[model samples]
Structure formats: structure tokens, C-alpha cells
Target: MRVITVEEHFHHPEVGPRVMDLSGPPPIDLDADFSTFWRNFTPDRELAEQLAGGRLEHMDAAGINIQVLSHGAMTPGSLDHPDATGLCRQVNDWLAEQISQYPTRFRGFATVPLYDPKAAADEMRRCIDELGFVGTLTQGTFAGLFLDDPRFEPVLAAAEELNSPLYVHPGIPPASVLRAYYSGNWPASVEFLLSSPAFGWHAEAGIHILRLILSGALDRHPGLKLLSGHWGEMVAGWLDRLDEAIGWGHYLDRPVSDYYRTQVWITPSGMYSHNQLKFFLAEVGADRIIHSEDFPYVVRTNVADFLLNADIADHEREAIAHRNAEALLRISPL
Candidate 1:
């Protein structure tokens, strides 16, 4: 069966100039210039070499159609704030252009100006109507507000109305968090992986998602689709604990697992372990899972091999490899 790798990722070099303005004196190293670190950290030549060596091709051999999520404006400084509609327009144009280049091999997700809900909503409409993007991708938190903030209601509402999925990926750390890690001489490479799972995934992603659920966002917008990265960011493992917490008359008013199973979907990007995949499938039906390589950050060849060879039933393997994403993205079967 042909598979659609719905969670592949790519970064645009122009994202640096388009998202940031470096005219002013470089602020602090950890806080202000972290964007520079991320941009410089991943060398394009290395990525090109991998792709050229048939690494990505191997995934194609496994019947996977790569769906690339074009890198968008990273927030920090004067570059491209979420409230900047003009910047969003430019980014949307870039994403559309990227998709056009590989119509069969790629599809795109839009980045909207999240600082302003009206602007975000407007840009989302344009991305869907004009650019034909599958959905919009956002950071776990924007500026300082979590996804559940009332300010973002319009953006969420628009996505639901348009039937577009919302892909939430990890971004830079908050100022306070960055300070602690930097002062401790912590390597970002290490800190990012650890913090994303330990802190952001649980505190920010989980809490915000729960807020959306309890607030009746999903109940109101039942068609809303949410895609999370890093194998659901440990959400699968937390289900039983979450149920225990909720059952014990904890903070959440409803069963946490209900929201997880019904309203959200997760991608197997950056996670390739058989046990992890199996756990996610058992906890949140295989249909809620999608395939992703977190490419450019992860070695594509290794991921393709892992997914293809994982010890799962043929049907479940096919579902995670491509079927779930196709259904979620509304992409026709190959």
C-alpha cells in the first residue's frame, strides 16, 4: 500500500530574513540570538547530502509520499510577529510556491499571525482558498499565551469552520526557561529534547489541549483536527495517570482520555521506537496516529526503516505509515 508521510518537515533559508530583523545590537545570547542558533545549527548541505544519497528515496520506496511542512517565521524580535498579516501573506506565498514545485511529492501547512486573531483568521482563509494548504502549523505556545487563550478563539474557530487541521510543533523556549538552561551551560540540542518532553509537552501542550477540551472547543467544533509531534509528546503514556487524576476529582472536569481519543491526532515524528509506537496505538487508536520523520532534524533513512520494519500487524503498519494522515489531510489515496 502506498503511504503518505504527512509529517515531514523542511526549513526555508529565507525564513531567517523574513522572520527577523537584525538591525539592532544583538541582545543576550540565550534569549535574543537563539533564533540564530537554530538557523545555523542545521546545515543545508548536510541535509542535501542525505536526500541526494537516496535516504529520502528509501521512504519513497516504502510507498511513502513525503508531505513537507515548510518552515515558517519563527517568533522572536521584530521579524514576523503573529499579528503581522503582511508577513503571514508573504509566508503563505512562500509555502504555496514550495508546494507548487513538488505537487505530487509535497503539500504544505500555513503559518498564521497568531498575535492577532482576526489577522490569523484572515490569513488562514487565504492559505486555504488561495494557496491550497492542508492546514496551519503553530508552536505549542505563541508569544506568552497558550493555545487555549480566548484571544485565539477566532483562529481556532476559523480552522474548524474550514475543516483544516492544526499542527502544533515545538518552538524556542520562553525567556525564563532559556536563561536557566543557558546559565547552566546546557547544550540546546540536549535541553530541547528533554524540555520538550518533560516540560512543554506536559505543561504547555497537555494543559492547553485540556483547556480547549474542558472549555468545550472540541465539543463546539467537533470537526477540528489537531496534529501533535514527538509521538503525541508523551500524552499516550499519561492517559492512565490522567484518568486517575480526573477520576480522583482533580482539576479537569472531564475524563482526559476522551478528549485525547476523539479530538486530537499525533504524528510519529522524532519517535521511532516500536514500544513507543505500540503504546501510542494502544492508547489512542492507530487511526489517530500519522507518520512523520521530523526530517532535517532526524535521519530520514533510519526513520523509514524503523516504520517499515516495526513489529506491528500489516494493517496497523499501513495505517501509521500513511492511511491516517491521508484521511486527516483529506488527501486522496495514491
Candidate 2:
């Protein structure tokens, strides 16, 4: 099957620059050998040989178009890594270049420095207006402030104005939390997966998103779209609990599920459980679920197979593999 891979990933050769104070403790050794780190962190050769090379053979093998997000390149250490304005320009320029290279098979999501909302908004505009990017991808939090912070209103406003979505992927936690996680000799490999969007769901990310909803951001700008990867960090399972809390008059005036179904979408990246997928679809609806492969770092061959072989009807499969992402990105069918 020809699949429109909306959530494919690519790493920049240089990802060490964009690191912020929020990524938790520096991975064990700040001075670790760069060459070895790059080899492990990047997906260039592997991805090229595997999916890009058409290595996985099946009669109905799924072919994917890529949408490159950031690797670790924009980390605080990268060359063009700017304070704010410079970062935006660098990312916008990079996205424009990607579009030029893969005009048809590739699309890009802008990586902006969320630490500064004004800078983020400007970069998003440049990426969308000039570079033709569908949306922006950002680490879960900037500095210590999560996305729900009022400071991010400008960025969200800009996205709403442009009718573009904001893709929120996981990043390391703040320095304090990093210390706690690291003190246990917890491997980042295991910890990052276990902690991410799920942790964010309970901690700052969920709070901020809830606040955003209650603050009327979605209501004011109905066109605004948001994408959460890692199956919304397990948000599907907890919606009812949150909804119940809200119904019992906790923080917001209305039910939290109302905002979720109306304004938010989730990508099935690491989530492959069919029952879970069905559950999410039942709760959030299929139109809001898009296909994602955490990619490179986590090879997506299995996910591709799972979606292709699933027992769902043709329309459901099509909706998840391509249609939903197209709608969110506003990309016309090819």
C-alpha cells in the first residue's frame, strides 16, 4: 500500500546545539565521543538502507513519504544555534532546503526555539509562508515553561491565524527532574520512553493544555490544530478521569474531553497495540488519529506492517495512514 507517512523522522548531522536546560541532566557524559554519539543517534545510513532503499519486501509492502522533523542538531550546541531569532531563521532555512530536495516525497516541520514565543511565531510564519512547511515541531517544553504557559499564546495565536498545526514531541525534562531520574543510573533510553508525554500528561504539559482550553484559546481560534505524538502520551486512557474531574468542577467550567476531541489530534508513533488503537479511536474518533513512526531511532517497519495488516476496514486504514494527516496539514491529495 502507498502510505503517506506523516510522522517520519530524520536527524540532522549536527543535533548537539539546540539542547536547553530543560532536557534534564546532560546524558551521563558531556564530553562523550562525538563520532560515536552521532553514529548511534542518527538514522542516515540505516534509514537509507531500510525504508528508503525499499529493503522491506512484501507483496503489499507499504511505501512511505517522509516528513522530516529535527534530530538533536538544533540542540544548544549546533553552529547556527541562535538565542531565538537566529534559531528560527536557521530552522526555516533548513526546511526550505528539504522541500527543495524532496519536493514530492518530503515535507518539513519547522523546529523553532520555543523559549521565545515571538521568535517562534516569526519562524512559523516564515516556514509556512516562505518555505511551505505544513506546521512546526517543538520540544515538549521551553526553558522550564511547558506549552500551556501564557507566554506561548503568541505562538499558538500565530498557528491559529495561519491554520497550521503544532506538533509537540517529547524532550528531556528540566534540570531538577533530570537529576532525580539520573541518580537512579536510569538509562535515558528506557527513561525517556517511560517518562515522556505520559509524564507530561500528568505534570506540566497536561496542566498547560487544560489551562489553554479553559482559557478559551481553542474557542477563540477554532482553526488552531495540535498534534501530540506517542499516542498522545497515553492521554486516551486518562480522558475519562480528567473529564470526570472537570465534571465534578475541578478547574475548568466544562468537560475536558470536549476540548480534546474537538481541537486535538494524536499520532500513533510508538503505540502499536490494536486494542489501544481501537480504544483511542473510540474515544477520540478515527479522523483525529494519524500515522507516525518514531523512525530512525525506533525503526518503523513493524508499525508499517501492523497498519497494513490490521483488520480494520479500508476507510479506517486510509484515514489513519494518510487522510487524517492531510487534513491536519491541509495538504492536498497527490
Candidate 3:
């Protein structure tokens, strides 16, 4: 099977310093930087080489045929950062450069400088129309403001018109949550900081997509396609209840699950829980499922083995491995 993994990630080494230069003082994330996690996850030298070099050989070894590259998690700054547009351009250019050298084995997700919505929409158009990008990845929010903010509607409209799906990744919970709630020690900050990537991250991403749903972005931009990782970021299986709660106040244009089923796509993202996959498949069906590995951050395992060995029917497994990605991404079958 040809494997086309989305959510493969890379980082520009200079991104931090540049964002700091333009973003004024950085957030707490910059100071603490979660070095403890990133250090062990990617390390420095090998990750640098992976970003600077190529991963075709590694993909071949692992039976991953292609990777749609995205910025690691969220882009590391507020959208209000003064140089957000420039930083976005630099990131997108670098992504395009990396993919250009290995077009057959890689694809690019454009970054839009979203501090300025007009500029972001324009950039989205350029990246897709001119740069041949597959789509763009916007993490949970630009700072705390979800993309459902009216300012960002143009970007959503542009994404739909251009046929570029928007992949919404997770972002950090507020610093207030970290400071007052999750601060310090095993049951608190330590566990939150560690487990957030697994559980908390999914909740945050789910909420963000939920905002897109309840905030009526999906209703306005009916053609919009939203992608989320970790089995639809906890939204896939619980649609009936989600709609039930939301519908208590006012009727939505459609049920929350209907919007989700039509507008959202999910990926496994190196999270290899057999039960989770089966449950997710049952909830969301196989059409909205796609392949992902979360790349260097979770690089030890082979996703191909998960696809081949997971307790799923052959056709469903084939869809998750590559067929769905091919249709969603508009790529020719190998």
C-alpha cells in the first residue's frame, strides 16, 4: 500500500529567535520552552539534519511513501506578533523548498501570517495557486482567538474556494490554566505538561474545531474541510452527545455530528491504540480517516506496521493508509 502521511512535522531553527525579535517579549512557552520534552523527542542534531536533509530513505525503510509536511504543532507565537506575516512567509518558503527537492515523496502545507487576516487570506491563495501547496495547518488558535473570529472568515472562504483543507492542530491551554491550575509537581503541572500531548491536546483541538462548528464557520463556509489529528481530536465518537448539549439552546443548521461528518477529517498521528482506532472508525467511518505519524516528535515506531497489523478490515485499513489521503489531497494514485 502507498502510505501518504499527513501531520509529518519540521521546524526552522531560526523560528524562535525571529519570532522573539518581532513578537516583543515571548510567552511563558518561550522561556520554559518545554525543553525537557523536546530535548528527548527530537534532540537537536538529528532533528536539524532531518529538516535540513531529507527523509525519503527513512520513509522508504518504513514503507511510508509520502509525507505532507507541516510546522511542528503550532507556529510558535501570537498571531498579533508584529512580524507574523514575514515569519509565515519564511516558514512556508522553507516548507516549499523542502518539498521541492522531493516532490514525489513529500507535499507542503503553507503557513499564513494570521495577525493580519487579509494578508493571511492572500497568502493562502498564493501558496495554493502559486506554490502548489496541498493545504495549510493552523493550530488551535492564533494566541487565544480561534479562527472562528470574524477576522479570519476570509481565510476560511479562501481555503474552501481554493480547495485547500485547513488542518487544525492543538495549541497550548492558557497560561492562566498552567499557572493557577497546572502549575508544579506530579499531579499538577508535570502531569499536565507531559500528558497534554496525549489527552489535553486532543481536548483543546476538539474544542477549537467545535468552535468552528458552533461558531457557524462551517455553516457559512459549507465547503470548508477541517482536519484534526488523534482520531478527530476526541470529537469523532461523541457527536450525538455533543449535538445534544449544543442543541439545548438553539437549533444548529445541522446536528454537530452532521457538520463533523461532512466537514472534518481525522488522522491517527503515531497514536497506535488498536481499540481507539476501531472505535474511531466505527464512529466517524473510514472515509474521514487519514494516515499520519506526527513525524520526528514520535519517530520510533513504524506507522506502516500499524496499518498492516491493526485489527481492521483490509479495505478500511487501505483507506486509512493512503486511499483517503489521495482523495482528500487530490494526488494521483501510485
Give the C-alpha lDDT of model 1: 0.67
Candidate 1 Cα misplacement greater than 4 A, ranges? 22-40, 45-63, 72-83, 180-203, 250-253
Encode model 3's per-residue lDDT on 187-240: one tens digit a residue. Answer: 433545543674666787888899999888998888899999988887887898
Residue-level lDDT for 32 in candidate 1: 51
Candidate 2: where is the Cα deviation over 4 Å? 14-62, 66-82, 180-182, 185-208, 214-216
Candidate 3 ranges beyond 4 A from true positions: 20-38, 41-45, 48-54, 73-79, 184-195
Greater TM-score among 1 and 3 belongs to 3
Clashes of each: 3, 12, 0
Worst 10 residues of 2 by lDDT: 51-60
- For all predicted structures, in order, the TM-scores are 0.83, 0.81, 0.90
Question: Per-model C-alpha lDDT, please?
Answer: 0.67, 0.63, 0.78
Q: Residue 325's C-alpha lDDT in candidate 2?
A: 75
lDDT of 2 by residue, 1-334 (tens): 4465555555433333343433344443333354455466555654532233432331124456544454333343122234555645654575467558657666777776665678778878988888888887766456666666678888888998998887766665665665565434444444443344345323544454665677777777778787776666656568898888667767665577878888888887656788878778788887888887665555555656777777777898888877887777877776
